[model samples]
Target chain A: MPHLIVEYSSNLEGFPEAHALDALNATIIASGQVQYEQDLKSRTIRTEQFVIGNDPTALRGFVHAELRLLAGRTPEVKRDLSERIAAVLRELTPHPEGMLVQLSVDIVDMDRAAYYKGTL
Target chain B: MPHLIVEYSSNLEGFPEAHALDALNATIIASGQVQYEQDLKSRTIRTEQFVIGNDPTALRGFVHAELRLLAGRTPEVKRDLSERIAAVLRELTPHPEGMLVQLSVDIVDMDRAAYYKGTL
Candidate 1:
């Protein structure tokens, strides 16, 4: 199981939520590395306060995603996944006059022993 | 560099923001496993919509924290860090009647080559 947390800077406008979610879900499904598409949990969070580099006043926007997956995938697969996610974000986020943007994706392993899920 | 992302359900009331942050920062600093206290980036995000287990209708709340650090830390250190973070969250989060609360922490390794931080 993998949970994708999408964190975007609140300074940005016109975020394509549906398109980005569909693209990411499709990317993971098409990779054939996941057990099921249903298991892929995705959520987006807009951060009002964030620091990029040292300049907080600069017109900067970022789309940072964290993907938590069950341990076992090879390093190559994780790297590829992170790169692909970043690429999708770069394509989806809008750019306006005097704005700088950065995109990053992190693929982290989940320890099955520590993770607990109860019946809903 | 390590980044700690705290994601908490928005439905919960009276979240102890200052206490949680200080406790976490202090926990990491006291562990002596990190390069420096300044190197740890901590941020809190309130999620508007989140699903735990299966039923979305249940009045359930969760505090999920993700810790990303350089890839050389031992497994023991990571586990200890995760547990300590979870314990701090449990102590800090307020519990109301009829609310099912769960706390979880994840410690993830960062690939130094892939993680990019520009001049701030």
Candidate 2:
């Protein structure tokens, strides 16, 4: 199972979340790393409030993504995937007039043993 | 760095996100796990669209949280913290009639060496 969770600052008013999400999904599918494309779950969360480096007055924003996959991949794979995802996010986020937007991508490993899929 | 990110189902008509966020921060502070309470930034993301187990008709919702902490803590500490956070989320989310809500908490370790603080 793979899940992509994106959290972006509210300051990025013009960002296209849904489009970026689809692009991310496409990137993952193109990687050929997943068993089934339909099983990939992706969602976004807008951060209404945030601060950067102790400066509330600073015009700063961020777009952070977390990609969680069932455990099995080596550390190298995670690293490469994270870098690619970061590039996707960075490209998608616009460099507005005066705001600083930090983009980050984190690759997470979900425990395989505890992971379950069944009817509830 | 410590950040609490909560992603919940938008179906929770009456779920108090801001208030529940405060309670979660209080719970973490009470745990005495972090160095500074001020550094702990909490935020919520509402999931507008989601599917549960290939069933579009299923009346189900979920509130999943990710607590990102700087690397150093032992697995035991992370597990205990996750459990406490889960409890807080469950207590805060209302069990609306006929809908099932799943609560989950994930403790993530952020690489300390790569973490940086800077002014732009």
Candidate 3:
């Protein structure tokens, strides 16, 4: 199984609706790759704000979404999971014109030594 | 410019000496890519421990080292940087036999919108 962590950066904050998180969770579950279903999980999205320019009065912040999944270790499976995540994020927050949204995905291969019984 | 995050998983903890972090910082500075020089930086290394088996008492934890670098975006440059990091980590922590030391490296392309004034 793999633990996936998706980190995204955007210029908008406090605009993502509550359903956005739900939609992300649903997308992952629907993929039929992860085992845990009862407890659909999410971390408190942390934002780091910055000023792009003083004259334009532009502001930007990064929102990182970390999702832990237990799945098989295969190249095709990893690619599919990454695409699904990118698609979900695009649906959740589409950036404005002249803006950039960067998404970085990480997969942790959970071996026997890395598995735990209780919550982390 | 790119922000690099190196996540490594191993089966040993509380064994890495204090100089390990210093060695990492020194390697990055010696790379001569990052601009900020006065403040050699590092975050507290966090560990997540797990047991492989009760009888053997095999334990594992993950060490994530995040480094921010500002350089021109080029494929060769990126490759060189990644290889340099992998080498440094290898020197820092060499794993035992039959154990898998997984290292996942991520790079954040810092654009105009993502630049900040002060510390994050």
Highest-scoring model, TM-score: 2
Best by lDDT: 2
Best-first order by TM-score: 2, 1, 3
The digit string of per-residue lDDT tens for model 2 on B53-112 reads 877777999899999987899999999899999989888898888898889999989745
Give the range where candidate 1 chain A is weakest over 10 consecutive residues by summed lDDT: A111-120
Instruction: Please list the C-alpha lDDT of all candidates, in the order they appear.
Output: 0.75, 0.77, 0.47
What's the CA error at residue A12 for candidate 1, in Å?
13
Point out the higher-scoring one by lDDT: 2 or 3. 2
Task: List model 3 lDDT by residue over A1-120, tens digit each.
Answer: 333343433345543646666666678778877677645565333332221211123333333344444434465665565566656666666465554444433333344666665765
Candidate 2 runs further than 4 Å off? A118-120, B6-41, B44-66, B74-107, B111-120
> Which residue window of length 10 is worst by lDDT in model 2 chain A?
A49-58
Give the per-residue lDDT of model 2 (tens digit) for A1-120.
799998887878877899899989998878877888987889997788554333345566777787888878776777767767776777787667788666766677789999986544
Given candidate 3, what's the lDDT at residue B99?
61
Interface root-mean-square deviation (Å) of every model: 5.3, 5.4, 12.3
By lDDT, rank the candidates, best first: 2, 1, 3
lDDT by residue (B4-99, candidate 3, tens digit) is 333344354443534454455556556666554323333233344444335464433444555544335576666666667667666777566566
Angstrom error of the Cα, residue A114, model 2: value is 2.2
